[model samples]
Target: MPTLTAYPLFRERSLLYLADMGNSKLKTSDSATAPLQLAREVLMIEAREVQALAERLDENFVNAVELILQCRGRVVVTGIGKSGHIGHKIAATLASTGTPAFFMHPAEASHGDLGMITQGDVVIALSNSGEADELLAILPPLKRIGAPIISISGNRASTLSRAATVFLDAHVSQEACPLGLAPTASTTAALALGDALAVTLLEQRGFSKEDFALAHPGGSLGRRLLVHVEDVMRQGDAIPVIEASRSLKDGLLEMSRKGLGMTAVLDEHGRAAGIFTDGDLRRAFESGIDIHATLMRDVMHRQPQTITPEQLAVDAVALMEQYSISSLLVVDQQDNLVGALNMHDLLMAKVV
Candidate 1:
């Protein structure tokens, strides 16, 4: 009857020995490196599996893409467990890439989500074993609805595959999991296959950057592609402008009143002649030029960088970066100053 603390050293050594015994290759002296070694092995296994899946691609893969392309309705992706998680991602990728698609849980399909399926729609089912009960339960209904089934499964002989309109094998030789229980390599292969399908469809449809921007209107991509200088530039009274005959002091006042750190210098004909920035003012003062006596036309930088109102805001950003300037004059086709913008404006619009 020894107390727990009476043999702490012996107990610690016993536990270490047991851990090493669990994996014959792992020893007490190098136990610290076990996790790193195992992680690398897992990645290698999954990578190899995906590579194998690529080489095994045949006409079945092509036929599946053709089927989805011909489908007039949405592509409905479904699965259970880990497969269901991968299915959800695949559906999102497809939908965002121009192919109309959605994810429907297999278990939910049996409980009335099946009504979402239409005759013209296409179904992509994911199941490593090809015999998931939840997925299998929905197959007959999916078939009855006249939707074509594209099954991605490890077992071609499984019921799900046999019932498919086109079966693409996503088989992997082994799991990345040390115990060979978790769906690691298999899920990786399935996800890669799904990506291939989505990208192929995207290319086939000639999906463009503008189309992608439309789907992601709230994202940064949309801002860069969809937003124009006219949408973010300061217009009307907000634009700081002064006639060429105006003094540098007048230009400074306009710049301050408009709070843009620069003023547009307009010619007698009311067209943009040049620009007077704070940098010019500083240089004028350093050169001992009287601000009140110097005309804007004399002190302003001639032929300042300008952008068209219809130009993309991202292009304006590029122009600013290329010239190492912060502000830009927005002009019309006739080079008339219609608006103005600075780095701050682009920052506010999140275009920078």
Candidate 2:
């Protein structure tokens, strides 16, 4: 035969043909079509099942929420394997959303973490087959404590389901996994159900953004939502203020010195009478008025928009947005100036 190097082009063409045939075979085969098609069909089916579970959510979900809401202690979630992982997430979501909850590994419970459960607490157990022996090991004691049990599982007839005060069916008709061994569709359904329960309880309790702030104190939402205008506003000497009879020159000097671009004019009783800004100074100058000779009382904008120091900094931001202004004067009930807040202040505070 001719040397293989002498036939390199033919060899390369043959290899490309083989690769194309292999890909074509894959495209036309049951092996390639079956898994993806089955997963899509199963996902649709499971999605419907999940929706039905949500719609037909009987007194059970309601009772479970009520049980958690009325719980004087924590909600302990327990499971094994993949379900255990999801249970951990559910516990975290519940805890962060006003329900006091934490994950307790079933195996750990067997080794005395069972003491974490007590009377007036609630137990949320998750298992796909609902027959995990590890989960069952501590059930009798958990039941003895009179803690109401909420079960999330596939089989309603499983021992875990039977022991529950409320059972949420997380059954998927088929696994999204091709081998049907991996927890795919079932885990998705369970996670969604857990979220539904957490959010439902969150809404029913009339939980506010401020309440969320308490749970997430380290985050920006917590700081912005929880901080009051007084907490972030400039107070006392930091405030830009001038008396009613002060010269516009004096107000401009105060504005420049305080770096707030504005100064509040206080009346005879020390109440905020008016405000003068750099913009006002420009308009006054354009009118041929003498800045050094004119009284701030005569040229300043009167009865300036004011907010209470008790208002939320977020609310102060809204006020700034609504009025199209960059600064606001915070005052007490008697209209006496207490603080000053500018757009830069809110930005620096990250309240915006």
Candidate 3:
């Protein structure tokens, strides 16, 4: 009963909607309307297929998981054609989720890529009909290698399924293609089944967000999980540290020298008493205060936002955005000045 959404306009019938919309047969005026109907019909078919396949989970799925979990070497996934493409994605998902999987093209297997598999490995083969020639060509060697096979296919009686130690049923009722010639619904069903296996294995392995972050450490995730405030914040002389008793002129001299647009004001005990920024100095100028006479403590914002060195850089970014500030003063657990960073620093690190 799921509603259909957008679909492939032409020739991308891979997502359970591979129906051959013979544009050659349609009248020019009806062409525009034909695509819409085709899209809706194909989407509906795929969604239902995904739902139905999900409900058809059986003991074979459990056996597949058990085999994968018991694997000593990496899981080698193989398939041909459209199924090969889906198998590649499933392998990626499995690897990123801590299952340690890789795709081995069946045709490439015949070209000696089969050496990638060892007795310690497990193989997940994909084919809608379970009868691809390239897949069958490597079955004997796969069997000889003593590696267990988990097959995902539309036919229970397929050669691939019959050869497997465990067979996961990804059979779909129909293809989204009007001619039933393309691998539409069957492919999606296989993908969903593969996802289920990967996710189930992920949970069984106790995979965590920290583990996922390690697998993806280049972008915002790295900034959030790997880069700490101390790793990126300016420390030592780079931080404009001044005493609260100092005059605004001295603060200005320190600020101008450090060029962080701000200076931290410390108390007699060397704890952060307050902070004075370029914005604060501008406001002070507007108020006509004497730069030589005003104490930094009196001219500064007394309660400034601060973070610990152990905090995440992304957290610092969040704090900066929330308060609409350009810089943040890094503090210790004892509230003493330790380091500082600005939006520009975040930009340089690509953390923002």
Candidate 4:
């Protein structure tokens, strides 16, 4: 529970090095010398501390995950200082990964936000020293409401850990800070532990990508997974269409009018024969073909790729990326053109 620096040697050496550097520019500090070496040592120290925490994981982590899964209400996370900042991220991670959670500032809880905590809920209290006064103040109220307290703290015997329903040890031997006072290593360990807990609960709950999309409908991930081609495609008469016997000029007029850079060519049976694109027009011009008299089918790409409306928009993007095409023809179960969409549509819909 000591807040005192544990690595005097490191602190002493770092202080002496900084003193030698005086006011020299840190951006131009010699990579082989004191400044760079000091930064590396801090990183290595924090990294080692995190590895040590991971190596010490045991039944406590499993118990913590189980505690959360059994709760019928939201998980209320509470912490102070640096641990509080880490707690906010942990709560977000848990919520996004399918475990309902929210950060409840300990001070807010003391100031009557305690109403936010109710029965059947779980409390995740974070404090490295396990002596955060604001956090300790709410444990009795939480216990009285039949809520479980899960403590992530470095001190196993501290007041917070002793009062918890479950204790998760996140002890770090040293901080990345040379003074070992700012919570560098301990905060990282707590965050990593929180991630482990959230992921384990997510797997246990059988959380799916579909479920995630529902939780995050406003983001690109939702657009990719939830939006279908039918949602963004130009349907019915908006699709540019022409018969195979039509003049290339007729297809060009349809393309210009539709503004989709391409026109769908239908066969005599009214099924898709092929598609004539701007690319095909350029090739015809290069070959000196008669655009004014040639039939659409002769200059079009036969067996053009098409998609069904039920397919995901992201799948459509993948198809376009794979085929190197900006536009795609949408077909029905009967292999008839129903709609068309291009890269611009995807971009406008934010499905790109």
TM-score of each: 0.92, 0.83, 0.90, 0.90
Which scores better on TM-score, 1 or 4?
A: 1
Q: What are the runs in model 2 whose C-alpha is more than 4 Å off?
A: 1-46, 144-146
Q: In candidate 4, what are the lDDT values of residues 1-352, reduced to their tens digit?
A: 2332454445555555677786564332343575667777777877898889889999988888888888999999989999999999999999999999999999999889999988989999999999999998888888899898999999999999999989999998777876557888889999999998988998999999989998999998998899999999999889999999999989899999999999999999888889999999899999998878898988999999999999998988999999999989899999988999899999998998
Candidate 4 C-alpha error for residue 122, in Å = 0.4
Which ten residues in a row are the worst by lDDT in model 1?
A: 1-10
Instruction: For residues 61-117, write the lDDT of model 2, one tens digit per residue.
Output: 778888888889999999999999999999999989888899999998999898888
User: Global lDDT of each model?
Assistant: 0.91, 0.85, 0.88, 0.89
Clashes of each: 0, 0, 5, 0
Please give the lDDT score for candidate 3.
0.88
| Model 2 local distance difference test score | 0.85
lDDT of 1 by residue, 105-206 (tens): 988889899999999999999999999999989888887889999999999999999999999999988887655678999999999999999999999999
- Number of the predicted model whose TM-score against the real structure is largest: 1
Predicted structure with the largest lDDT when compared to the true one: 1
TM-score for candidate 1: 0.92
Instruction: Give residue 15's error in model 4 in angstroms.
Output: 5.8
